[model samples]
Target: MATDDLNKPLGLPRERKAHRTPLVALVAPPLLIAIGLIAFFAFGDGPDDPGNVVAAIDDTSPDQTGSVGPALTPVYEAQSEPLVEVKPTGGLREVRGNDVIISDPSKPRPIRLAAAPFEDLIEADENGLLPRIGDDGTRPLDAYARPAGATEGMKRIAIVVGGIGIEGEAGQSAIASLPGEVTLGIVPYGEDLPATVAEARALGHEILLQLPMEPYNYPDIDPGPNTLTVAGGTAKNLDRLRWLLAQTTTYVGVMNYMGARFTGDDRALAPILGDIADRGLLFLDDGSSARSRVGAFASDSAPVIRADLVLDGDTAPAAIDARIKQLVAIARERGYAVATATAFPSTIARISAFARVAEENGIALVPVSSLVRADGS
Candidate 1:
């Protein structure tokens, strides 16, 4: 039913580096240094190389290490005309080409820094094909992510009830019944995806898109229309993926619907995983099959956190309760645990009741994101 962080470099095209007016350009460091040395030694000025004059006014900032060597610095040739002398009127001002500009010192300069935090870096296109995140410095997925909210010594348990939005009423009930900390997975075919997402967000539960990928049964037991398949090849699969992604927004990640066969094939899953990584989203394995390649494929390309347990494989009240207890035990033993289940009414009731009581036992039920890697790496 359900569904994961870690960065596999998404390789999204680099946003233009922010254009900054460097401190040297404004302060004329080279000019000041040259003037000072001359004044101290011979009480006279040195010959002004137009190259040095332009270099002194260079707005190019430092490199990755914040140090620039001459080889790395851009060389602006001396124009046939002599270099123009720029007088500082005060504040932040720099020379570009032959013109000198002045900026108000009191006002803040606008810098659309690509390397800024996630909130600043995320930009939604009009089509919203597949949203992309900026460099590793900005992880919108992690910024919008959830923490366990557990006490210092509490064992954390995170669960996701998948298959929401397929059967409308059933989906609604699952959203209302389950605690907000429990994550919900929505199908792309939902009659009203936006409304469902809005209601789920209102309830404080994080949403994930459930993609229908091919299963072992194939045509005999189809998950849904447009199931991602190896036969579709990488290009077609990505096209299908774009459609699924367009259905909603603010979802933290995506998980497979019935992808046992499709997920196991690396040739089919690798490119898909890369796309997921490229976007600022997580990937949940659902742990539906032992042979699923999501775990290994994720570790190598896009890292994922596979479910530690399937909460309602048997859907019976007693079975679900037992699984909750087992999950709590595992969490207590391992410090954190992850579980996935369908939206069966009985399953929902049993796990909800167990989650309420588990807290009294020092087990903190957390959002599924608690198990995700924060840096999305």
Candidate 2:
């Protein structure tokens, strides 16, 4: 107290030091923290390290074990030409061409077996028409055969060989010449209508009888000797219709040869429509005239519509081509269209061209029944 009393206030011992000594110690911890934060912000993880996030999620470090497994790639081989794969069956096999592939090892592989080649369904003649196979054998004309150059679910064109003066062996030959998908429209004018009907049934083709009806402005045009008319009144007309239907035993439906006059009168045609509906048969209008009430009557009869716009009034190649284009255009606008032409060779060629157009355009060519069935559905 005596020595330090001059410098101190007489209560405590004097200890003098730098002004900032304690302050330095106190602020050192916060200053160090600030420096550490700056360093972290400047040099922490960044995009330069691509593996930072991806590697973290995938965990695909270079040190991982076990193989990742083989990479998948398509397996297709070069071929000289298109190959047709044929599976072995238990019957005699007849491969028509050398390019046909007997078996392929890449797939599950076809089981090899012995079987006979398919016998020709119809015995073909010079022009590709087939004769009735045998006296007892049924004729083999199916309406829904596979189409020419067809894949699964493709539309087909149907044609029948019996309507236009084709009979017996000649008729069979024409039917055979037709592609399998054509519907066989048979007229009863052949030598033996029943026999011809039997043959058509055997061919697996759809059979429909052509009904004779009264046409406008052409009363002399004969559908057949026994035809229905408005002149007969209700009972007689019904009887005549029943008889006409009975003429062909296995026809699934009927189309008018010419009926502009009779169809205009609903009173005369209603009973006939009832008979057709009662039999579960379809009515095809042929769309002869716009005024034809066949469509109007079909609502009650559950009738099918035939949207035929292309008759190819002329069979010239260019004319036929134009009509076909018109047909496709109409088909694209509507869901579908149906047109019929005579059985002349020129007509056949024209239709064949139209079929090609249908293929190119991805249009379907289904049967008349398909059109009818669609309405019911």
Candidate 3:
């Protein structure tokens, strides 16, 4: 009786044999379902998905069918507007109301002029037409000098670029490129004196007659024809000066070319300066002569201003730039500074670059005439 009962558990009645599910049977359905889902996502393109959508096209159009269009073609229409007249201001484009101000990098604002050869300012002498004070007490310094605009609180820098008209190309380059506030020192012996001067004046540069005077080495180093000399008496030097003044019209003053010996001698210099004062012209000392007696005569004679620096003494670009920095420092310290330079190509290039940015640095480039002090202060 008990032989069958050995395989069964000892339970109250004969327990029904329990059935166990196989692991594969339990997991196979879900595993198969996940594989199916991944395959569907990877390979199936759903109808409602934008990524699988295809654009419809009308293949019936002439352009798509390779047929030519008609002879009449559509044209684009745009409104045409007239150009406005722009006024030139230094290096900035400014807009005011409906007007536009454009900057001309090449053409600087011109200094105002009173027109050349005021009849009252000229007198016939043995040399030529000499500049003189008008019968109504007007001086050439006032008549021909470029009027200084409102400088106010800014530091003032006056630059005189000399040797213009001496070399044709260099002179033209200087005139064409330099700012209007720069004064030009025209040599007495340059060709086309009147025409060159007129061109420079038209561009707003104040003019100065560069008087050739004897240097320390006198005859060994001549200053060219009609040079004023310490040996030349006041009468003789005055004659030579008149010749120089006669070479050009509309100059505000005279600047010495090479006058170490001539300017150091007060006896020889005073009378010449006195004559310049009598003619109503200013006198500029180029500052080359350390022993110059110009200050001694300035109180009694022509208004005098000495150059604070010679910009192109070295003629290198770096040297010129360094000198310009020094010049600004001087101006900042004294409220005004004057510098003289030859019309060298390097000098003109550096000055042109400097002029474009001078105002922003609080430096006002004024005409040399503006800095001339009668008492030589």
Output the number of the lDDT-best candidate.
3
Poorest 10 consecutive residues by lDDT, candidate 2: 55-64
How far does residue 343 in candidate 3 sit from its true spot (Å)? 0.3
Model 3: per-residue lDDT, tens digit, 224-298? 999999888888888888888888788888999998988889899988888889999999998777888887776
Candidate 1 residue-wise lDDT, 124-156, digit = tens: 555354456756654445655544453578888
lDDT of each: 0.69, 0.50, 0.77
RMSD, one per candidate, in order: 22.8, 28.6, 25.2
Backbone clash numbers for all candidates listed: 4, 27, 0
* TM-score between candidate 3 and the true structure: 0.70
Of the two candidates 1 and 2, the one with more favorable lDDT, higher being better, is: 1
Q: Which regions of candidate 2 deviate over 4 angstroms? A: 1-174, 198-204
Ten-residue region with minimum lDDT total, candidate 1: 108-117
Instruction: Give the per-residue lDDT of model 2 (tens digit) for 13-40.
Output: 6677634447788689789999998885
The weakest ten consecutive residues by lDDT in model 3 span: 57-66
Per-candidate TM-scores read: 0.65, 0.55, 0.70
13, model 1: CA deviation in Å?
91
